[model samples]
Target chain A: MNLDELYQTVILDHAQRPRNYGELPQATAFAEGNNPSCGDEVTVYVKLDANGEKIEDIKFKGAGCAISQASTSLMTVKLKGKTVAEASKFEKTFHDMMTAVTLPEYPQGFGDLQILEGVRKFPQRVKCATLGWNALKQALGGNSSHDPVTSENE
Target chain B: MINAEQLRNDFPILHQQVNGRPLVYLDNAATTQKPLSVIETLDHYYRKDNSNVHRGLHELSNRATEAYEHARRRTAQFINAASADEIVFTRGTTEGINLVANSWAFDNLKPGDEILLTEVEHHSNLVPWQLLAQRKGLKLRFVPALANGESLDLAALDSLLAPPVKLFAFVHISNTLGLINDAKQFCALAKSRGITTLIDAAQSSGHRPLDVRDLDCDFLVFSGHKMAGPTGIGILYGRAELLEKMSPWHGGGEMIAAANYESSTYKPAPHKFEAGTPNIADAIGLGAAMDYLDKIGRDNIAKHDMELAAYAYEKLSQLDFLRILGPKTNRAGLITFVMDGVHAHDVVEIANTYGVALRGGHHCNQPLMKKLGTPASARASFYLYNTKTEVDRLAEVLHKIKEYFTR
Candidate 1:
């Protein structure tokens, strides 16, 4: 319930002045992700390596809440050098951590996504927190129609 | 004057607190709170008359049929439609727009034909036209808003109504801006050019007194949730002739007079448009909502909302960071603004912390927000039961929220 769990310094730093918060020059993969419930949005880009195994670069360009953008910013940091397979796992972990969906790939340090766990409690902002990861999964060939409008988290 | 204390008693849910403060629900633009009359109507239907409406033989089904037909009649009266047959029960205004776009516009629109819309149109109004135009190879035209944001440029609209312009779409009031556009004058002008018109009354129906006959629109759409009714039901008022001419959007049971393998004929007007079993309970509930509104006298509700909105506008304008969007020349019950150096969501979160339930986002009008040169906005929408005291709490909490974020 305390802001401590939700606003860890790292998430705050990324959210306050987000890094790589713009579109890229030769975007590898692009997908539109939305939180239709709250109207939050995020477009994730990951320039994958030759094998599409590792992320060479990542960026986002869209308007979203702190949790969403911060989560995207954090994923952009944590996802570097991670294979598409690894990202699928990280995504599973992050998804489970955020939505309690119990997916196989859900990651640890949900506390890393902690600023957003307040989202799980609020139920409304879960979309805001997960917009980025959902977008990331879409770019990594998980699924294409990543519309958050009908997403259960929203 | 609205009976604040007495009126507040009917809404059992509004009395609760949020975060740590008394709930100040100013999101009527998004959805209005249901009154006990409407709630009771839903309960009464489910408890007693829960059956498939229309063409039923059993007593329960017959009662349901009567109540459902009675709601159609009541809604017809609510909008002053020529007949109950002209009123179609839809899911909400969004569904209504999609219905019209698919049913009417699909048949009528052609390549190079332009559908004219205004800047203040909501996504429900704007997106359907966009889809129709995209699907039919039609061009979408828009009349730009003036600097003050009070209304669209009538002269520009006149110019835009050239031969290619087949339909004109717009909102009676901007949900984000609170500008009540001059619908009669505008729609009349569009009609002179032989243009069909659709008005998104989602924001206006509950906030303003409406006379669809007087407005003379080919179609008018409003949601039940935004007008003290259940969420799943909305009313789409179309001229009987227009309704007769249009095809059905969704094809299913209950909309046809007869169904056989070789060939099937559809029913006329409202029945044709309403294809499934329909939201019978919600439709009955909507009837109850209209009855509640009639008892209230919409003029009185409009006046109450207008006064509170004006007062909220003035109070919020006193702060430099708080800038209300759109025209201030007197609107129905919406006030959108930005807090300096703060994101709208942040402001919304802080306000949530204080138990003030205002809305924050593009409010389903991202293009309008872009026109206003803002990413998103915070909106505090007023409704029937809301009072000046709640407005004061909104103002106080907004300041406290700004401080919370800035500090």
Candidate 2:
């Protein structure tokens, strides 16, 4: 249970400069996630293709800790060009890895997300890593309420 | 100044270690760690004087009633209330403020009457009034603080209290920013206008000696947990005449004189406010806490607290990227800050690896956070038990966090 494991180099780099971070201009779906205890809020936005099956673009806008912000940026990279069903599966795998004690098998395109596996050692911080992914799940599922999806509530 | 090293030993919880390091507790503004004296008092009460007060006519009841009533007197003396009758034991500061909002304001306030509050109120002081205003169609106005979200702008208070201001409720100290308000001046201004005032002393009551009479406020409320006492016990000090005029906030066995099927005659001021069985053991423990504080002398405690805060401030301010909240001078015993590229929760998460406990959030003042334009900040509060060495550890942990994030 090393501190370096939880705050690896890749996570810090992504948090410093998040990718595809901002509101997507009127395309598909949006939802917010929060770790209420720490005041970390992450709002995720998704834009689907013509058939509404493939995610054309994804963005997020909010303020939060490093783990949440980084996970959100990395989620956009994994989600773009993927079908909605595949994105949901990736989200499930990510959530499972975060909460799982033993190292779970990483799904496809989950290479970068393996950095977040360290969050499982720290139970309280598991939510910080999963906050953005939860919002992504809600957005792709077409839940429009931006009332903040908390890990505790789920 | 008080001897923090010696005092730390009295608090048994502080003797332990966290994360393989000596625990550094900087969350006193959230709740203070209790001394052995207070703990022993609680243990003794439950073991020996366990009985229902004001109901049983037996020997244990007599002892329990005496101890409980004695606690009220002790609390009144500690706060310099006019009398023990004015000290009503409540669940905590939240319940005390809610009691006032429900019993006093509900009975006296009109539809268009306004209640003036400051921007730095904790949720306990803010939400109860918001609920009341919504229900009764009352107007609620706020006196915005200075740009730093620390102290109130006294100049703006005059304008905000222009007309129809029924009551002014403000915190004696901003819990999030550690800014001490000029409660005496605020209460005097409200008094001159013939408006009532209530001071939320949840933060001030523990670190300093509070004389309600000197403050000249009609009502003052504070929690025991924040002041080295047990939880589930607090005191609401109201003027005797005002308490007599206000309606009872709760109803049950001990608060009534005569109960009928439809109508009942309620008891006097404090009794009427305290319904059912109170937190009798905690109240007794609070009395012991009062005695402990008296022995240390609050003036010394206040000096010690301020010195620690100043040390932490000076040390943490050395970090160029850190933005510390609150005014530099006349601050209470805490420091809230946010790093340039790191979030507060991340700072707290990293600090935990070094055995530091900091509060990272809005501190239940979400509206104030929005007003200050800071989404969140990490707060490290101090008390008599905290040492300058702990402040150094905090600074070191913070430096490591900054390095970790920036690297």
Candidate 3:
């Protein structure tokens, strides 16, 4: 019931002024994710480096709650320089954490993403924290070039 | 006069606390808290008369049959239908609408025929026709909401009632906007044009007086759960002649008079629609809910609702951060709003911390949400058992949410 745990200062700051919050004009990959229950939508656009394996640039544009927007913003920062495989691994780790089955030891480099681990206690908010990650996965997985892939919490 | 505080005692579910604070339930539009009268009715039925209706020759079957049929008669009187035969039991409003869409409209409407609806219909009232239109190659036209997003445009409605428009369906009260339309006048207009009319009265039947004979709509639908009754029970009031003319929606035992290897003949209007063994206990519980509401009186409930809505609107509007939806005048028993910087989910989360339950979402009116240009909203709906103190608490929680998010 503690509101501060869910709406941490970092979360609110990222929600208010999200980093890399714009449409990527030079994007090679794109996907849209929606939490229809709460109307949280995030569109992720990624511009991959030559060879199309490493993410050269990533940006997200959408509206959602503090947790979702903050998670998306933080995700763009953490996954920018990583290869597509690394981003997918990170997404799996984050999903496991939100689903409350993360390993005790942190993955090699969790960075600021640990702040969102508090969401594990709030079961209803797990979907909010993972919406952006799911969208990012959709962007990196194949079919990003064909149609704007859309994903839901369900 | 209905004393909400006194009536509150009758609902045992309201006495609990959530998250260490007194529970303030404002989600009445989604479903009402079942009163002890309804609960006890269900208990009594299950305890003594738990048998299949109109099937067995045992004493319990006879008792169950009598109770279920009596419940139908009570439901007919509750809505002031022309006769009990006109009231067909369905799972809920969604099923009732589907029944009509499948039985009446499927048979009556053809390719190029149009069904007139409004922009503010819930998905239940809207989606069935959308599916039917796609399947039958029927055309659908909408009467757009007025500029305020509260009332319907009568002028557009008149213009759209051109030739080949077979039926007109609309919600009596918008669950999202909390605006009550004049169903009688709307029905009269459609009736004058010789168009079949249906009113989705899921929100209105519990909060106001409903007279099917007075409204004269060809079809009316409402749910039991929204009226302090059990779930999985609702009524579909169709004109006797129209219901008789329409083919049976679902085929099964209770709906048929004689069945053979070759074919089957159905019963009269009401029985012909109710296919299988119905929700007998919940139907009896619905009767109990109606009896309870009748004692309180729907007119008084309506007044209580309006007073609560007006009070909440006046209070919540003071917050510059909030934008209220629906009519400023002559609104229904609920208020839906969105905060300037706060998402409705966040607003609901903080309100939950304060032990207040407000519905936060599209409210199954996704198209209407798009029309309002907001993805979702926080809605606080009132029932006859709600009080000004609860409204005040809601306002206080909303203020706290605004202050919490803005700070």
Model 1 error, position B18 (Å) = 2.2
Candidate lDDT values, in order: 0.80, 0.89, 0.89
List, residue by residue over B326-345, the lDDT tens digit for candidate 3.
99878789999998878898
Tens-digit lDDT track of model 1 for B1-407: 67766788889889997866688888888889999999999998888889997777899999999999999999988888889998999999999999999999999888999898887788888888887877789998888988746667878987998778988888888888888888888789888889998899998887667888899889999999999999999989998889999988888888898989987889998998888798999999999888888888888888888888899888988988787787776867878897775668877876777778888888888877777777778999988888889888888888886665444
Candidate 1 wrongly placed segments (more than 4 Å): A1-4, A8-14, A17-64, A68-123, A126-154, B148-150
List model 1 lDDT by residue over A4-52, tens digit each. 4555566667767777888877767867777644446788878887876
Worst 10 residues of 2 chain A by lDDT: A99-108
Best by TM-score: 3
Q: Report the candidate with higher TM-score, 2 versus 3.
A: 3
On residues A40-69, what C-alpha lDDT tens digit does candidate 2 reach at each position?
788998889889899999899888888888
lDDT of 2 by residue, B199-278 (tens): 99999888999999999999999999999999999999999999999999889888998999999999999999988999
Chain B TM-scores of the candidates:
0.98, 0.99, 0.99
At residue A12, candidate 1 shows an lDDT of 61
iRMS, candidate 2, in Å: value is 1.6
Instruction: Give me the candidate number with maximum DockQ.
Output: 3
Over 4 Å off in model 2, which ranges?
A: A34-37, A99-109, A144-148, A152-154
